[model samples]
Target: MDSSTHKLYHEHDFDSRQFLENYFSDKPDMVFGDDSLTFLIENFRHVFTVGHINGDILIDLSIGSFVHHLYSACEFFKNIIVLKVNNRCIMELKRWVDDRTGAFYWGHTSTILQEKEENSDQFEDQNAKLRSAIQHIVKYDLEKENMTDPLVLPLADCVLSAWLLDVISKDQDDYIRYFRKFSRLLKPGGHVILIGVLNITYFTVGKDKFQGFPYDEDFVRKALAGEGFIIDYCKVQERTAVSDLIDYKAVIFIAAHKEK
Candidate 1:
């Protein structure tokens, strides 16, 4: 768990396309993934399907640089600001939002979300709306006093982080620091949507290996409680699919709100 062990944030080294393909290529066995896809949809739906989550702004802080996490969020948030650690990942996400060539197909994810919403099977219209809701895609420095740097945006109504802190942080203590930092991005009483990947230390994309933090359900519940948040809903999806692509025990979906 040494902070020095993480070198995945650099450009080109992370392989954004490969990362998406491995986890979200949409072939079941849970999409060549463990319960990752199932947990992703269910967790996101936990927020978006709720009437209280609708707001004017959402801050999505993610490491994988995929838009699928926001498949359910787009309709609820009028403006979305995506925060990224690497320049290449920022570019990769932008290409998809701009409808450029070579972007990974997230239409499959959209369909799943649409079905959850009880909406009609209209992929194109929904995808367009998702792209449009995202108004800003910018660089983020997690270790800084201000994550967005030189532009401290207004505190958002909700912060969406999926498999971010655990993958990026070096150890347990650093993970706690990152959690507090995330709270600063929100107003008091604002909500946080979290996806926790359990009991794994590393993952592979193509031939490249990335670091992950091994954590449990108790660690997550305690972390949020310690951070001044009330656990509103927490669901655990056991990893039932076998995949040589990555190793993880389970995924925990948490929807918590900061105490007023």
Candidate 2:
């Protein structure tokens, strides 16, 4: 990785909409459906449904403007607080939550969740439930002691993060440090659901490629145990999508609870 040719994570101007289209959209060009969208949604449904990781407030600190992961969650949690490091991602989320014009269509994701549960609910009704459940979408600064500065957020019953630590962390130490920050938001005995990619160097959004920290399952398990979390459920799906957009070899889902 040359310092001259490649841009740092902060240096790239991330476009939330373009990022969604490239990886998450249902179009023919998009190739991450089976690997990312379906994999994440199905795993989340399993955890929230049979895993019994239910709670009142679920705080989300995710990588992008994705709402698909929350479909299953909204059914189990009453209030969902979304925290974002990027303003663009925040705006994109707000656009969908508010049902503004030109908001990205997520009907396909809802349909996937519905099919997984073998339910007959319309996608529109499911989207409405998700929108109503999302109570806040606030900008956060990871460098700050209080990530949601001045807001003084309530301790969450469940903390959910997807594809965030790897993209933001500069090294393995940074990964654990950030994971500790996420754990702090969970109340005692509360659960934390983490979704991350494994053994990848970079993920491209638009024309720019941002760096990623590569780590194995053993490393993540140790990190969670170090933070006083008890592992409950873990699932890893081997990479099935063959695209240059990301080099991740697998996707991992982890459901763990804080040691009371």
lDDT of each: 0.78, 0.88
Candidate 1 lDDT for residue 81: 89
- Compute each candidate's TM-score over C-alphas: 0.91, 0.96
lDDT digits (tens) for residues 16-117 of candidate 2: 999899889989978889977999988988888889988899999988899999988898999999998887888898999999999998988877877876
Residue-level lDDT tens digits of model 1 in 53-112: 878889988777788778778868899988888777888898999999998787677666
- What alpha-carbon RMSD in Å does predicted model 1 have with respect to the real structure? 2.6
Point out the worst 10-residue segment of candidate 2 by lDDT.
Answer: 2-11
How many clashes show up per model?
0, 0
**Where does model 2 exceed 4 Å of error?**
1-5, 8-11, 122-124
Report the error of model 2 at residue 71, Å.
0.4
Model 2, residue 136: what's the lDDT? 91
